[model samples]
Target: MEGTRRTTLVLLLLACLLFLSLLATANSQLRTDFYKDTCPNVESLVRSAVANKFQQTFATASGTLRLFFHDCFVRGCDASVLLFSPSGKAEKDHPDDLSLAGDAFDTVIKAKAAVDSDPNCRNKVSCADILALATRDVVALSGGPSYAVELGRRDGRISTIAGVQHSLPHPDFSLDKLNTMFTSHGLTQTDMVALSGAHTIGFSHCKAFSKRIYNFSPENPIDPTLDRSYAFQLRTMCPINVDPNIAVGMDPTSPRTFDNAYFKNLRQSKGLFISDQILFNDARSRATVDLFASNNAAFNEAFVAAITKLGRVGVKTGNEGEIRRNCAAIN
Candidate 1:
């Protein structure tokens, strides 16, 4: 009986190593053509669904974009953020993620349904891949650059409320803090700045940035770095004791477009988040922000590269994870 126990332990160790090796190999081989044969119309199916959602509400673009970022950062693009828990303890239930709009989850679910409606594609695609595709579609539909997304990701089974606490960047992070977090995921400072450009199309609730306008400091009522006029504007829009759920545009200049205007907003101290303003306030990252603000093409190129790299984080592939039948529940 002791020998049998020892053999079982050995088999478990071997299985773990094999799984790691397969993951490494599969992660490197995530290509755009991963489902060409299995689901030739996968991209189109996802695009159509995302487009329909986008037409219904422009929030669909920002919500889905933010959703993809949240999902990837927490569990490495495994769609773990989408998992629902009966105990009310999944990643989405975490305080940081609680703000994630339902529109984003609906976008992915809609796309998943569209994909599965096709007999050849039913159960053939992973929620992770569908999310990645839907994210790209939303960005393009909102007038951002269109890029090919790497696929072949499988849905992760683990989704714990505790897993999300330290995984995401906060609204008030400094440039140094931002760099430290993004760097851990193999993203450069430029990548961090570029990815942040997504704010051009998103909105942030008053709770996320009210500190800057009302009580930024004991000495100064408003954040010194904020444009005085913009601070007043924000104050008027988000008064004291305003509903925390009441939101404002993340990019004041071009609230609904995906463009370099976010960087431009940073230059004028109109960045809605302290983390956004720091890109220009700190000299080290100021050049990149200035460049992106001046050249839309450069921002688009860097954003695509950065987000493509972001998608590769902590990916589960090559049989390591399953193609979830429903994104909200682990199978």
Candidate 2:
């Protein structure tokens, strides 16, 4: 009996020691000391890149979403979208919102510049590296439950503006249409609104959404019951001018801030973009949008979760892809 008891005690001790070892391994793996690791600050890199690119454009929604649209649509965030001409990987030129003028690489340049500024980025994070990582991180955080993203993605050296129209979701799409657009890219309707929640950050041009205001044609009908005050406000900036190049932010109340104002704007019928307003019109997503508007904490949490899911779409992990040295050039 004494020998049996001794063996049991020994086994328990070994189990405890093994558990402790596993805990320590996980703790070390989870450590995020930027000072020690050569890895650049992903959050900072993403924020900075987003800020830099969207200084002039995309004020209400996050530059992160814009980057996602750019990355995922063409080649699954392969950084080929960042490449200008001359590189082998050319994107088919597609029409985007008239406000963006179908420009490419604006977001990529900002991301690359941000990473380049970091001293720790040397030999660790490159423009291409940050592009891949930031794109993945933003998409993941904007969708479902947030997950940690893997680093080390290679960049490509080609960009074609062709076929962008097919890649981007149309502003005129209904909720079901929107769902199809997202699911086609491995996302859901929940992901659609959650990603759209990024509208809390940047701006949009009047030209992009003016049709919803003055032009009440059958193809583009404005909600007749929209708030008069908000309608007046939009008209002041976006006149009947044929060339509405003037960019007015979607969330005029809080253009630069990241918050639930976009949702609030939607409730007020002041959502600048047609796509934005459609959230409120849809029965399935209307309550969710209202919930987010009234409850910011809930919105923030959901937004982060959604973006994390968006990041994982078709990622090239574990030798599936190479890490490019430069974001603008091909590997």
Among the numbered candidates, top lDDT falls to 1
Q: Write model 1 residue lDDT over 1-331, tens digit each, in one string.
A: 9999999999999998997686568668799999999999999999999999999999899999999999988978999999999999999999999899889999999999999999999999999999999999999998999999999999999999999989999999999999999988879999999999999998999989989999999998999999999999999999998988898889887887888999998999998889999999999999999999999999999999999999998898887889999989988
lDDT of 1: 0.93
Candidate 1 minimal-lDDT segment of 10 residues: 19-28
lDDT of each residue in 288-323, candidate 2, tens digit only: 898888987788677666655554444443344455
Each model's lDDT: 0.93, 0.60
Candidate 2 stretches greater than 4 Å from native = 1-61, 86-93, 97-129, 132-150, 156-158, 218-222
